[model samples]
Target chain A: MSGKVTNGAGEGTGGSAEGLDAAFFARWMRAAADAVDREADRLTELDSAIGDADHGGNMRRGFEAVRSELDEGVPATPGSVLMTAGRKLVSTVGGASGPLYGTLLRRTGKTLGDAEVVTGEELAGALSAGIDAVAQLGGATAGDKTMLDALRPAADALADSGGKDLRAARTAAEKGAEETTPLQARKGRASYLGERSIGHQDPGAASAALLMAALAEAGGDAEGSA
Target chain B: MADTSEGARVGIVLVSHSKQVADAVSSMAAALAGVPDAPVTGAGGLPDGGLGTSEEVITEAARRVDAGAGVALLADLGSAVLTVKTLLAEGDELPDPSRLLDAPLVEGAIGAVVTAAGGGDLAAVAAAAEEAYSYRKV
Candidate 1:
C-alpha cells in the first residue's frame, strides 16, 4: 500500500482497465477485507471519539464475512460475486454504516447485472449508484463531515476524468478523502460533535478511500493481465 | 445462495437498544427488499437491558421473529445472547431464530433479508447472518 496520496485527474500512476471477471472482483474484495481487518481497531478508535466505537469492528466483521462467503464458493460472474458480497455485508453489519455501505456495494453490483466482464465506464456507473444510494440514505451532502464527502467527489471525478481509468479514479478518491480533515461535520455522530469534529477525520471516509485505493491496485494487476 | 423463495420463509427480527434502531433497520431492510409490501419486520429492546434482564429482551425479540418466517433473533449485547438462548429452549410461543446467533445487526440483518429475498433459504440467510458477525470493525 502506497502511504503517499496522489491528487487530480492526471494522477494515473496505476494501471488501466483490463477485463475484470468474478475471480478478479473476488480478489479485490478480499484485499479490501484485509485492509479493513488490518485497520479495524484504528477505525473504531477514531469512531470512539465522535461516533460509535463499533464502526471499525462492524466493517471488519462484515468484510470478513464477505471473504468467507466468497471463499466458500462464489458465483460465476463478477457482478454476482459483488452482489453476493454486498448481500453478506447487509446481514452481518448492525449499524447505520452497515446498510449504507452494504447498499453501495449491492446497488453497484445490481447495475452490473450479470455481466462477465465489466468495463471502466460500467464500474464507474456501479460506484456512482452506490454513492447515490448512500447519499439518499444518510441525507448528507458533499461538504458534510461524512463518508459521502469523500465518496461523492471520487465518483464525480472518476466519471468525468481522463479516460475513465482506474488509477485516475483512485487518485481522485484519495484526494477527496484528504480534503475532509479541515471541514466541520454536518452529518452522523460527528455532526453531534460539532466543533470538536473538525480536527478528527471520519473513519468511514477513511475506509471509503481505502476501498478505492485497494481497487486501484487490484485493477492494476488486471490491467497487466490484459 | 440457497433458495428460500418457494414456500420457505425466514423472518427478520431487528434487535436494537431502542425502537429507533429497530425502526431504522426494518425500514432499510424493506427498502432493500424492493417490494412495497414485503414484510421485513423488527423488534427493539428499548431501554436496552445491556447485561441485565437478558431473558426478557430475548423473549420479546424471539416473539417478533416468530411472527414471520420462523424468526431469526439478533441482539446488541452478550447477555442478549444468553437471554435468547434460554428462550429457544423454554419459550413455546413460536419457532426460534435464535440459532442464527449474535450478529452485528445492520449488515447482518440486511444481508439476511437481501439474500433471503434473492431466493436464499433460511439456513443460508442464517449462515450469512453468522458470517456477517465477522464483518465487525475489528
Candidate 2:
C-alpha cells in the first residue's frame, strides 16, 4: 500500500503513481499472454531440438487459462490479481514450466501483500522474491539455459532501475535470453541432451524474455495513457 | 485428516508424462492389491492429450482420492516431480496430509497403493513408496 512512485522522468519521488494499479497488472498479464500465444510455435520449435517439443503448447495453454480467469473477475489488488493468475497457471499448465512460472508469480504476488497500488520499487522487490522462489523450486540458476537465464537478469535490472524503467529491464532480459543460445543446458529436459543442447536457445528463457517484453510494453501503454 | 475408524486409508496419486502409462500402472497396482476401488489415481498427460503432466489433473486427482488420512504422490520424471513439489509448496487447495515420494514410479505406485489399501497412515504409505527405492530385480 505504501511505496515510492516514479515520475515521467523515471525517477522515484516517494509518491504513488496513478498507473501502478490492479488494472495495469491485468493489462500486463494480458499482454504477456498474447506474447506467449504469438510465439508459441517458435517456443515449441526450440524445445523440439533439446526438449520434448511442448514448451510452446504448454505455455499457451497456461496463459490462456490465466486470461480466462482474469476475464471472470479482476482482483481488487495487484497482488491478488497475480496470485489468482499464478494459481490458475499452476493448476492448468502441465510440465516444469507450470511450477517454475507459477512459483515466480505466486511468490511475487505474496511479496506484494495486500497493497492495492504498488510502486516500481515494491514491484521490483516482489519480482526478485518471485524469481528467487522459481530458482529454489526448480533448483536452477543463471547459466542453466533455463528461464532463469532471462528472469534473473531482468530482476536485477528491474531492481537496479529503481523499478521504474521497464524498458531497461526488458532489454536486459532479452540480452540474457540471447546469451543462452550457446550454453549447454544443465536443468530440465534439455539436460538430457547433454552436448547436443549447446547450440540451441532455451525455450523457457525465450518465453521469459517475451514476458519481460510484455511488461515493458504494458508499462509503456500505461505511461502513454497517463 | 479425517476419521480412520472405518479403516479409511491414505490415497496414492501417480503422476506421469503419459496418460496411458499412468493409467496402466495404477490399474495394475489396483489389480495386484485386490482393492478394485483402491484410492489410486492417475494424473498424467497434458490437457490436450500430449506427453506431459498437468497440475490441474494432479490437483483434481489428489482431491478425488483423498479420503481423510492424506495422499502419496509418485512422479515418473524430473518435471513431473517438480510440478508436484511446486503444487504442494503452494499449500493452497491440496489435501493437507499429501506427500510426494522419491522412488521408482512403477514400484512406488505398487508399494504405496498396497500400503494405503491396508489402512496405512500418510507417513506409512509414503514410507512404503520410498521403500521401493531399494527394490532390485537381481
Candidate 3:
C-alpha cells in the first residue's frame, strides 16, 4: 500500500522511506494497539503489586478505542491521526494513563502541525515536547518510577539517534522500564506504597516500552517489502 | 446574601472515581448549601459507571454548573486529579474560569458549594474548598 519505499539511498527515517507519511503513522498505531493487547496481562500483574489492578484493562480499553477509530478511517495528516487517537483514548480509558497518554499523543500531534510527511528529527522533537507535557502534568521527572522513567530515556535515545532509529528508542524504553524495579515510586498510586513500591516494575513504564517496541516494529515493517 | 460581584454566581463541582460517590457528594453539598439555587454538580466513573474518571463527564458537569462566576472543581484520588488536570491543560473545553481545586472530596464539595451559594467569587470559592483540609478531625 505504501509506494514511498526508497531506492537504496536511505534518508534514515528508515531504509525504505525518506520521510514518514500518514500511512506509516497509521501502521505504527495499529502495531502499538496490537502490542498493548498482547501484553495487557503482564501490565496488570505489575500494577497489582504496587498499585490498582486496572492498568492492563485501562490500556487495553484505550488502545482498543484507538484501533477501532482507525479502523473506521484514518485521518488525512499524520498529526490528525495521532490527535484523533489521543482524544479517543482520553475519552474512553477512564484512568490516569488515559489523560497522560492522551496528552502525550495529542501534544505531539499538535506540534507536528498538519504536515503530511515529517522527518525523523521532526517527529523526535514533537515527541520530546509531548513527553515534557506529560512530565508537567504528572509533576514527576526521569527517576520518578512512572511512565516518564521509560518515556524520558526513550525520547532521549530517539533524539540522540537523530530520530531515525526507533530500534534504539525501543531498547532504551525496555531497559528503562526494567531499571524501575529497584526504585521506590515518588508519584502516582505506587508512591503511597513507599518502600513496598520497590522490586516492582512500574506498569506505566512497561506499557511505554510496549509502545516504543511497536514503533520500532512498524518502522521495520515499513522498510520491508510487505 | 447579596452577590458582591456582578458576574454569574460561582459554581461547585465534585469529581470522584465512582459516579455514585460524586452524585452523593453533590447531593450532600446541595442539601447544606447557603442559597436556593445552588450551582453545584458532580460527575464520575466511565460511560459504563465503572471505577475511574471521565473527562467527558467532568467537562459536562463543569459546564452545567458554571454560572459565569466560574467553577471550583474538586476531585478524589490520583487519576481523578490527573483527568481534571488534563482537561485544564486543553484550555478550551471547560469554562475559562473553572479551576481544579486541591481539596478533599466531601469536605471540599460541601465547602465550595456553601461558599458559591453564598455568592463567593471564583477565588473565594476555591480557597474555601481548599481550606476544607484545615479542619482536621482528631
Candidate 4:
C-alpha cells in the first residue's frame, strides 16, 4: 500500500513532504499512553472473558514505563525515541503483548533510521513495516482477532492516504476493532476458548484502535501548532 | 557419556508461566540428572512474580547458563516459546549455538540437563531434549 506519496505534501521546499519532528512523535507516545490508561479497565474486562485478564494492566504499565523513560530525557530523533520505548517495553512488559508491541515499534523505528524527522509517507511506510513485524512475531493474521485486527486496517489506511490523513487511519482502526467483536479468536490465549471467544471484542485489537486514535489526535495537534 | 569438560558441556534453560514452576522444574531436573552445578537456568513469570513469561528474564537466564557451551531453551506454553524466540532474534548478546526445543517441559528439562551435565555438545543436548517427546510411560 505504501506505493508513493500522493497528496498533502506539506510545506517542504523540495518535492518531499514535511518531516514530522521528534516532539510530535513524543506527543504521540504520550497520547497513546493516556489512551491505554483510560481504557485499561475495559481492556481487562474484555480479556477476562476469553483470555487472561492482564491486557489492560500490562498495557498501562508498559506505557507508563515508556512515559517515564521519555520524561527522563527525550531522544534527539523520533526513531531513537521509539526504539528506546520499544526496548523498554520488551524488557519490562510480560506476556505476548510485550514482545509483539515491542517488535512493532522497534521494527518501525529501525525503518525510520536515524533521521531527525521523517515525512508522513515515510512514517506510513515505517508503520507498515512495524505492523508486519508484529504479525510475523505473533504468527497472526488480520482475522486472528488479535492486535493485527486493528493494526492491519490502520496501516493500510495510512499507507493508502500516503500517511497524510491520520484521522482516516484512526477511523479505519476503530471500524476494524469494532468488527472483531464477532470473530472467533484464532490466535493468542483467546484461541483456547474456542467458540466462546466469539462475540467479545478482542482486547488487543481494542487497544490498538485506541493507539491509532491517539496518533490521530497527536497528528492533528501537531498540525494545529504548526 | 560425553567428556564432561567445563566449556564443552551444553546449558539448559527452563521457561514457564510461573516462576515457582520454573524453579521447581529446574530443581527436579538437576536432581534427576544428579548434577549439582549443572548449567541450568530458570526463566519464568514476570519480574513482579505474576503468571507470565518475560523476554528480559529469558535473555538473562540464557546468558547466565551459557558457559562457553551453547544454550537450549524449553518452554511450557505458547507465549513462553514466542517470548524466547523473540529474545533470541532481538537480543544483542548473541546467544550463539542456542536452540529452542519443542519438547515437553518437565521431561525435556530432565533429559536436557542430564545430557548437558554429561558434557554433551549443543546438538546432542538438543537431541536428548527432543527425544523426550517420544518416550511412552505405559
Candidate 5:
C-alpha cells in the first residue's frame, strides 16, 4: 500500500467518450472497497491524530457492504448501483461522513435518472449535483478542510475537461487531500479540536481521494487490478 | 373533554446514538415536564444495539408519538444529527411537520417536553427546544 491514494497508473485513462454503465459503477465501488481496505490503517492513524479514529473502520465496513451488495446481481442501472451503495453507506457507516457521502451518491444517482448508461456530459452534471448536495448536507465548502477539499477540485478537474482526463481528476483529488494537512478544522468532529487540528490530515479527504482513485481505475483510465 | 384555552401540542422525538441515553433523556424530559404522558418518543441507537442513529429508527419513533399536531426532533451528536437531518431533508419519510431541533439532547428534550406539555404549538415547541441552545446554567 502506498498509504496514499493517487494517480498510481497514469497511462490507462478511461477515454473521454466512455459510456458509464451499471457494471462500471459496480466495479468502481469494488475498487473503492479494495483501496479502502488497503489504506484503512493509514486512515485510522490519521484520524487518531485529530479525529475519532473510526473513519477507516467505518468506511471499510460501508464499502465492504457496497462490494457484496453489487455482487448480488449488480443493480439494473448505473444509478441504482450508486443508490444502493449510498444507502448502504448511510445505514452501516454511522457518522457524519456516511450521511454526507450517502447523500452525495444518492443525489448524484438520482440526478442521473434511469439512464442505462450515461455519456460523460450527463455524468458530469450528475456528479456536480451530487457534490453540491453533499456540500449542502455537510454545510461546508472547498476550504473547510473536509472531504470537499478533495472532492470539489476533483469534480472540477473532470468537469473542466468535459469529463475526460480521469488521471487529472485523480491527481487533483490527491493534491487536494494532501493540501488539507495544514488547514484548521472547520467541519465535522475535527472542527471541535480548534487550533489543534491544523497539523493532521483530514481522514474524510483521504478517503475521498481513494474514491477518486477507484473512479479513475473503474473508468478505464488507470491500470492495476484491485 | 378539552379546554379551548389549551392550544394544540406538538410531539417530541429524541434521537441519540445510545439506546439507554435516548430513553433516559426522554424519560427525564417527561418527568421534568411534570406531565405523566407527554407526547415524547425516544428513537435511539440502531435496531441492532449499535451506538449509531438511523433513519428507520427515527421515522418509527416519530410515527409512534405523532398526534397530527406536529413533531419536534432532537438528535444527540454526530450520526444522530446527520441521520435526523437526512430524514428531514428527505421531506417525505418523517411526519408532515417535523422539525429537527438544533439543541443539546437533555436540555432541548426538557424544554421541548415542557413546552408541549403546556400545550404549545409546533412552532412554539420547536422554538422552546431550540432556545435551550443558549440556555444559561451558570
Candidate 6:
C-alpha cells in the first residue's frame, strides 16, 4: 500500500502510503508477546548469570500485563495502543526492565501521538524515541552491552532507510542484536559483572532484537491477512 | 461497561526494586497528561523482606485512586506480588484480580493505565495490560 517518495524527501516527515497501520502494529505486539512467552526462561537464565535472576520472571509478569491490557479491546490508533502498553509496563513490571522497556514504548507512542495513520517519518521518530528512552532509562551508552547496543543501530537504520518496509528494518535490527556480543559491558545489570557480561550476548539486547523480529513478522502477517 | 466520564480511569502505582526504577517509569507518565498525573507511583523494596506486607502497600496505594476509577498494582517480586495479591483479595472490592497478574510490565502497564485514564473500561484496560506482553522478546 506504500509508494516511494516522489515528493520532497529531505525532511523525512512526509506520510507514507505504506507505513505500518493499526493491524500491523497489533501483529507486531503479538509477535513480541509470543517471543517473551517463549523465551521467558532463557531471559531469566541470563539474568541469573550476571544480573538479578528475575529477568525472566520480571519480563513474564510484564508481558502478561500487556496481554491483559490489550485483550480489553484493540485500540483505535497505533500510538494509543503502544502508549497503553508502555504505561502498563511502568506500573506493573517492577524492575529496571519495567522502566527501560516502558520508556521505549511510551516515547515511541508519544511520537506517534494522536495521528490517525503513521507515516514513515513518524514511525522513525517513534522508534528513535523508543531507542533514546531505553538509553536514558538504562544509562547505557553505545558500548554498554545493553539493549541499546542493538536498539540504537536499529533505530538509526530505520531512519536512514526512511522506514521503507519491514524487510530492511528487520535486517538492521538483527544485525544490531548480533553486534552486542563483541562489546564489553559499560552499564546496567550486565555492566555490574564487568568482563563476565562480555562474550555472552545481553539478554535485554537479545530480547530487543526479538522485538524487532516480531515487528517484522507482524508486518508480514498483516500483509498476508490483508 | 464503558464510562463517558473521564474521572473513572484507574490510578497506576509503580513498584520496583529501587526508587530509581520507579522514578524512571513514573517520568514516562509525567510526559503525558491523559494518564493520571502521578499515575505512576513507585515504592522501593527493601532487601531481607523488609518491604512490608502486600496488603499494607496496596491498600495504601489504592487509597490514592478513587473507587470509580479503581487501581492497578504492578510490582517486582517476592512480597511485591504477594502484597498486591493479598490486598486485592482482602480489599473492599477487587479491581479485577486478573488485572493484578500476568499483565505485561513495561508496555502493558503503560497501555492499560493510559487507556483507562482515557475512559476505557476496566476489562479493556486489563486486556491492554496483558497485550503489552506481546512486545517482549522470548
Best by TM-score: 3
**Model 6 lDDT per residue over A22-110, tens place:** 55566567678887888888888867776776777667777787878777776878898787787666556555666567678877987
Candidate topping DockQ: 3
Interface RMSD of each: 11.3, 1.4, 0.9, 1.4, 1.7, 9.4
- For residues A67-143, write the lDDT of model 3, one tens digit per residue: 99999998888789889988888888888999999999999999999998887778889999999999998898888
Evaluate every candidate with DockQ and list the scores.
0.05, 0.72, 0.83, 0.64, 0.55, 0.04
TM-score of each: 0.61, 0.90, 0.91, 0.90, 0.88, 0.60
Each model's TM-score for chain A is: 0.86, 0.90, 0.91, 0.90, 0.90, 0.85
Docking class of 6: incorrect
Which CAPRI quality tier does the interface of model 2 achieve? medium
Q: How many Å off is the CA of B99 in candidate 4? A: 2.8
User: Per-residue lDDT for A123 in model 4?
Assistant: 88
Off by over 4 Å in 3: A1-17, A221-226, B1-7, B34-36, B136-138
Query: Which candidate gets the maximum lDDT versus the true structure?
Result: 3
Q: Which ten residues in a row have the lowest lDDT in candidate 2 chain A?
A: A1-10
Clashing pairs in 3: none
RMSD of each: 13.7, 4.3, 3.7, 4.2, 4.7, 14.9
Q: What is the DockQ of candidate 2?
A: 0.72
Model 6: per-residue Cα lDDT over B1-138, one tens digit each: 476445556666665555566546656754553533545455545322332222333445556654456566666654355445433433343444324635645565577667666667667667777787777577
Share of reference contacts found in each model: 0.00, 0.80, 0.86, 0.57, 0.54, 0.00
- Tens digits of lDDT, candidate 4, A57-140: 989989999999999988888798888888877777687788888888889888999998788888889999999888888889
Question: Could you tell me the lDDT of residue B42 within candidate 2?
Answer: 87
Docking quality tier of model 4? medium
